[model samples]
Target: MTHPALIPGIGVEDTPRVFSTNWAVFGIAGVLVLGVVVWGFLAPDSISAAGAASLGWVTDNFGWLFSLLAIATIGFMFVVGYGRTGGIRLGADDESPEFSTVSWIAMLFSAGMGIGLLFWGPAEPLAYFTDVPPGFTAEPGSRDAMLDALAQSILHWGPMAWAFYALVGGAIAYAAYRRGRAPLISAIFRPIFGERTEGWIGAVIDVFAIIVTLFGTGVTLGMGTLQIASGVEVVTGIGPLGNAGLIVIITILTAAFVVSAVSGIKRGIRALSNINMVIAAVIGVFIFIAGPTLFLLNMIPASVSAFFGELWTMLLRNPAQGNDAAAFMASWTNYYWAWWISWTPFVGMFIAKISRGRTLREFVTVVIVVPSIVCIVWFGIMGGTTMLFESQGSGIADAGSPEAILFAVFGALPFGVVLSVLAMISIILFFVTSADSAAIVMGSMSQRGKPEPSTWVTITWGVLLGAAALALLLAGG
Candidate 1:
């Protein structure tokens, strides 16, 4: 194992002391995360309401900041990839990729934003289309309405989101692998901090990263557990899965993540990712063949074109212009940007962890392009199929909740029940993969970026994450 002092490429005098400093961070962060979880359990409503109010204030006041940073992040990815620095390497001059390109992409894509698409891809477009964004949305059930809705989904889930992640991942990878620093976000500030990178300031940065990772992972787990519980109710004809049922679901799924996390990334994360891709492909294929195949095919180009065509308008539209715009930004665009930003340090480092030995250009291109294109296609097919239902008044857009939208679409297909079960399985696996990957990132950061953190640390994070999710669900979020 590389010592923290030796991990710093320069100024290595006190390795042991530096390791102690990092453990101090680890202890503080763990305690803080547990504290928040306990607080949520004791005062669920107050915590949830307070957190929501804080988020609302930021989204309302700093809407421009989020929009500006998003566009700037995208531009940075493009410039860094094709500029003079295009040929820069992430590691040693002659180093090669740690995993095959396919496996690497699968792992990152799943970790980055896979399971959310199971719901949002179908739900968001339809939701926006039905209510419309007020100022720009088309007439309900019109052809233009279809275009507008698909375009909105494409934009929200497209290249821009991935670009934020690509830049963060690129910076971390270059800093850690090339500069020979621990794979912590703090390491990226080494130029400024130098020896101070091993001190309190650096510890603060890592602590913030860990807290964000823990809370973000908790949110994912909570949302995913609720969705899984709902899907179970759908497939098994089970009762409405009250609070008790949801807790049971969280416990079982959390156990799954703990096991996968402890199994080690090469086996657990990778295998689950392969299965996720296969199951996702199964659903997509089944929908394309069984649904409005031709219209869905046509939607691919139409949605892509419309997304780019309306890019500037969507980017610059002031959310405060009208009630609809305000609600849309608050509920959709603002929330999306916030979640993406919070997850960046976690997902970025996870990407960087598996991205050693790839060139800067290769790294950026794959990070920005592949997931973006995959998102477009997934939304196109899934959203397009749902539109066929909505255009004829299928009521899917007005369904129980966003998480239930995909299952609603499946109900109309042959062997719908079986496919829905597979989907629920896919959701479980995706969350498992994500939580375990996040646990690895948190564990690695806490351990001074050890390539392989101890299994005990990994398991602890996995279980704590599950407990945090249980807390959130109990809190009525």
Candidate 2:
């Protein structure tokens, strides 16, 4: 066996400066993406119908699998992190983290769940509060409802979600740094495929990763665009901008992220993520202070407790709970599980890139625990405040759309327009950071895990990502 140190792309000096392209993977993914674009444009209604049906079928039939997979991932991470492998480093034992703890965390939070938290923080809890899921008896506007809502929100965005990312990210990092394999998803399967990992099997795996990343990114970009569009209408006093407007916004943001992606990870991704974290913190603090301060403080712990107390119930929910429970799962929990799984490829790869030199335990702790706490706090504040508003008849729940709920909550506070504007900026920045990271991951995968994929390759992936998002938007979403 070749020693890990002698691998082709093992170190900075030995790494190839060129693209070292995997044309098979790149070409196949490109063709498939192009087909999606053409289908989306030529038959948008059909695309929408097909997408809805596919999502429905998966959520209804395979939701149990999603739920089972999520909990199992969490348990697997715990066992792996604390077991004998806990002390093993992702890189050389003497190596240190490439980025500071704060920066690394900011990137992880940003790429893994930034836009999602921004878009869903207030909306989801309020949603659950308005209509409690089956098997829960909390009154719509009661304190119990508020706690349950927050708990459910945490369930979706917290540990169960991040575990997927940590598992995939840890596997990729181990394969690349410890085993001296290329960083491709295929490389991780080498234990099974052996030498065939370098053949069609490897190309197939990489291509699958690219497609998943592309569409996963498209789903997230779509959310950001919708929220931004809603914000634009709120700030400008303009009417709804329809699908055409969504496409235009998608184009602009896509261009921005493409530029950022080509600027390299250390410079563009890190800087924007750190700055965005600061801005997000400012926004969060402002909301906590300007909203019901005491209620938020009280709800934070209450919600965290509620989440843990009910964690198993939420995790084990399935069709057996009855039709209503199954329906709820299809719409919410199951859907989120599937979304997170779809996203692990890109988010996991990004986490792996910045997470070298950490022990398995350390990596798991940071990736799962830290982000889960962030989500819990974020919901406790944003969702808790929104619930407070609704209970007081502020009508925040009537915000017409989930994307507009945060702005509606802002409208009830001082400096409403100012908050809305800042919220818009934050969403756009999060959108860019996530997209840039996805682009880099796709580029790296296409080039057989080159650490620094060629700039044009990154650009190509970015443009394709935008195209995929645009197609979804044009298909009525």
Best-fitting candidate, scored by TM-score = 2
Q: What lDDT score goes with residue 265 in model 2?
A: 91
TM-score of each: 0.94, 0.96
Per-residue C-alpha lDDT of model 2 across residues 416-449, encoded as one tens digit per residue? 9999999999999999999999999999999989
Query: Pick by lDDT: which candidate is best?
Result: 2
* Count of steric clashes across candidates, in order: 0, 0
State residue 135's C-alpha deviation in candidate 2, in Å: 1.2
Distance (Å) between predicted and true CA of 150, model 2?
Answer: 0.7
Model 1 pairs whose backbones collide: none
